[model samples]
Target: MTDPSPTNFAAPWEAQVFALVVSLREAGLFTWSEWADRLGRQIRPADGPERTADYGAWLTTLEAILAERGVAGPESVAARTEAFLRAAEATPHGQPIRLENDPLYRP
Candidate 1:
């Protein structure tokens, strides 16, 4: 599914999920179905609990996968995470204001 955010990147949490999937698959840590099942179970109703899906857990899983694959490290994951955060912060608040285009409408 496509995210509606202005940026063409996944949200921070979504990125983590994607990374997890990739890391696991590359290392043969878990089958796609197994990973999906585990992640689905992690998500819960927002107001349900103080502790929910932990991003750290996902990172740890990724690290384990990398280790299993004998890969160098998570340099790429860190870079992607920084980029996603920058994009999120750069997004503007509320609707874009066009004074000449909407002269009749006043904020």
Candidate 2:
């Protein structure tokens, strides 16, 4: 039987994150049940805002799981995020951003 869940993404990054999660799961990084449990907690924290279909939460959960699994620690993730931001800032309009574009890029 075919699944009927909505597959629409509001942004390209959302689709990318979704694909990353699926790839990681397929690679045995984590199970769907574990992902769902963590994602549920992230989406419905007692003091947090109620969220539904929040791709941002998916990203956050992915990061957390990766860190928990020693796949990529927070420091590395933060550094990469900074590098991407710098690269984006250095990129000219209508140009694709690349990490090599970052002023501090080495090699």
The CA lDDT of each predicted structure is 0.56, 0.92
Which ranges of candidate 2 are over 4 A from the true structure? 1-7
Per-model TM-score, in order, reads 0.35, 0.87
- After superposing candidate 1 on the true structure, give the runs of residues whose Cα lies further than 4 Å from its correct spot: 1-55, 67-72, 94-107
**Cα displacement (Å) at residue 69, model 1:** 2.2
Model 1 lDDT per residue over 1-107, tens place: 47665663346766766665776577776787766555454454366653344565455555555655666367766655565555555545573433323323234
Query: Highest lDDT among the candidates is held by which one?
Result: 2
Encode model 2's per-residue lDDT on 11-103: one tens digit a residue.
Answer: 999999999999999999989999999998888879878788488999999999999989999999999999999999999999999999999
User: Which residue pairs collide in model 1, if any?
Assistant: none
Candidate 2 has its poorest 10 consecutive residues by lDDT at: 1-10
| Cα RMSD to the true fold for all candidates | 13.3, 3.4
